[model samples]
Target: MSFEFIEVADMSTEADYEPKNIFLTGGAGFIGSHAAILLAKKYPHYNVVVYDKLDYCACIENLNEVMDLPNFKFVKGDICSSDLVTYVFKENKIDTVLHFAAQTHVDNSFGNSFAFTQSNIYGTHVLLECAKNCPTMRRFVHVSTDEVYGEGEDFDAKPMDEEHVLEPTNPYAATKAGAEFLVKSYHRSFKLPVIITRGNNVYGPHQFPEKLIPKFANQILRGLPVTIHGDGSNTRNFLFVEDVARAFDCILHKGEVGKIYNIGGCNELPNIEVAKSLIKILGKEKEMDDYITYVPDRKFNDLRYTITSEKLHKLGWKEEMSWEDGLRKTVEWYKTYTNRYGNIENALVAHPRMTGTSPTNI
Candidate 1:
């Protein structure tokens, strides 16, 4: 299960990086979609090829702003398909690959662990296999999660750095860590010019309702109960998707190869506080108790995931969106724009683990 480690290849730095065409797996999902839009519009010369399976969390409408762009192309395909992934790289003459496709929900991973392993590990392997064969490839940016560092429950503890030990607590985080190992192997063995990013909890528009902010925002907007796991003491550093998009752009253009970067948000808030913020935004603070519900926690829920992003900051990337602005923008979008899942009731559940349901096709 290992690729042979070999000498590093002649690669390009920030100024030397000449991206002919860019490839993004899961380019229609939350963070992926935002990145697609930013990359496509910002670099109109670089052909942006979006290869997405259009999973439950993805919607073609998410890329509506860039749909008509001449440089933006969308292909409905899975990263696990070696043939398709290979064909895309060869046909597009792709030099940059941003791997974002994965089963990324922790709650669902409890019951649907295999899907996580398959998408997060094996699927990533398939993409790496194809990426290694491309002579034109200069960058393979693997978008990972800070959860792979596992629990940093102590809010006051020193934030984990890029070299921090990988200690995943749940099935989802374990699979993500496994995928990171594969990405690193490719960089070491084949000199694939790889960069890995461990980003914190990302929120903003285009996010699926299954996640914390969107789920609670949806519930509060609908006058439904905002379900909180346990006593809602679990804290997460929330980053705006736009900021994350900027971070990816900076990394793609200037990040050092063979290095790992942490994309973190300055704001860290407990689950209860976040829920309350959304409630207040919806003008329902008076009925906060009625609009909120307590649910049993997962078998293992980490209180916090602390990671430093000084490395990314050195690349001239910083989070610009404040918590209040980001949360307000997210809630406002979900309130008016409806019709992604049709009956998003399943997504708004306490712990959505719906398997085999057909995802959208872009």
Candidate 2:
């Protein structure tokens, strides 16, 4: 299955930037998989080399859609392994590095904070060091999270633009902020063409059930109680995975180097609202009282996270997926792809970190 590549004029530099061979780290995980499939299908001419360590929550099956594509290739390796990262860069002739690999779950970060630092901070360092040596490297887009901005008490308050200060409250978010500083340094000191993106919570089909949305959906599917932290008033801005994939595509083609873009979503729903939506979508709305169970909230759960995407909007990319439409699609996708993760018993647990579930939400 091939797709027509849309050519958007590169406005970031005087010289036009073209993406040919892309080295996509963490290409098998949720958002990464969506981006990988999009790049591989949309730009048939672009070679997508997907490298992943296949962490516990990251399933290899997620990349099955693009496995047979001639332009797509997968390499099982750790980004922290400097030797392996360098070899992949040289062998694939990778011109662009989409750094998507990281330990990304907040719940697990509290218990396993060291792993987050190693992968989010040290792994990013390894990629920057390797990309610096590659003459062909043109772009290094680091994927950051909105959580780095910490809590936003007022839902109607001024949105956090790229210039907003990063006040991460959790170990997971702190590590991502630390990694962003490194990315900034490499661009300033070494002059490596780089861009940064900080996006809101993403909900979609391939997501491991460790997250709030998928976790609730999975628990409901098994006729188990849908657990909520605290009273479930904590809110998150959500973007459909497909929408985020396109946002990255826009940044890849037309985004300015050495700049940060906040990929904001219009849908800002609280946790309980999300749970209720999923239950309704799955035809279990009548049983909401039984399925909805409240659990102790995380040690430092942020009340809200908000960001403005005016910069990305100027890039001709606004989210096309509406909340109702996107949520229904996500629930439907989860229904069909439930078995994608063989035995999601651990991921379905309310507190994966306490139960030895090793997922860093990315």
Candidate 3:
């Protein structure tokens, strides 16, 4: 199926809105980098401008492959800066916006709630304000997380749907939920064309080594034990990064405006189980005792997160890579990169104290 948006004067239908200049936020990060590359290559006619603040966990190396693409360009700026956001939006005549910038780590949010609020909530509002005034803007794709639903009892009974109430357990999720409300409000109050996507945990190459899959994989490669919060039973649905980009592309082209869609991966596993599986994948089963460490639980750890993507699936979007396959690919990439580079410190966007513990929005 074609995921290209059609150009029109009225912009009444999805096919009528063809974006020539795409403003992509957070393109230096993992998922953003992937999406930017796909859009630049797939839609060569569109100018893809990547605007990012290069936060602690954002690595410029992630975009190394597509940096030279004729259609691709990068701008170093913060989304919270109205002046910068406004300048880029007006200067580029950005008609399409894929917002993926935010302070995403739940753990860090506890100590740095202000940062999350500033970046995720305030930053999103800045974008909305700028986009609302942009005459050429057609689509605003706001990427959110499934964690907004929290781990309430209802989650155990059923996967979260689009209508699920926002019950974020941590500061990071709360900020994201707040951002969603802002985006929705803009659509309602200003008639801004926007689509929101809440995706499950995303794992693949180019991910900062702070998340579960990459964190454990890197630790294993360094001959260090993988640290697990609490008993490691907290579960989450893991989706491949490529599938996430596909979902974004589909939503950008086919998703109804002012609506929300859940992008889910069917693969779900407990944290401990995930650790064991990774040990096996790395052929470190014999060193399991030495390679796995159970730590104190997070102050406010959610038991699990589940979401249904029936809405997105109906739009011809489904995960192409299984969890095992994706995990293997991720492991192989980290192993080779580590062997060649010697330390992940080189790829880090900031000091280890920050990037290593910072929770990513994915």
Backbone clashes per model, in order?
A: 0, 5, 1
Cα lDDT tens digits for candidate 3, 1-362: 21222223244454534679999998988899899888988989989999887766677777887899999899988887899889998888899999988777666777668778888888899999999999988889999999998884534478878888889988989999999888888877788888889989999887878678888888787777888888887888899999999888888877877678899988988898888999999999998889888887777888888888999999889899988899999999887664432355433311123443222323
Candidate 2 per-residue lDDT, tens place, 1-362, comes to 21112222343543435799999988888899999999999999999999988777788888888899999999988888899989988898999999899888888889889888888999999999999999888889999999888899786878988878888999999999999989888876778888899999998878988988889988998999889999999989889999999999999988888778999898888899999998888888888899889999899899999899999999899999999998888888888999987888888887886333322224
How would you encode candidate 1's per-residue C-alpha lDDT over 97-150 as one tens digit per residue? 998888888887899888888888889899999988988887899999999998
Ranking by TM-score: 1, 2, 3
TM-score for all predictions? 0.95, 0.94, 0.91
Arranged by lDDT with the best first, the candidates are 2, 1, 3
TM-score of 2: 0.94
Instruction: Tell me which of candidates 2 and 3 scores higher on lDDT.
Output: 2
Q: Where does candidate 2 have its weakest 10-residue lDDT segment?
A: 1-10
Among the numbered candidates, top TM-score falls to 1
User: Candidate 2 local accuracy as lDDT?
Assistant: 0.86
Model 3, runs deviating above 4 Å:
1-12, 15-17, 152-156, 339-362
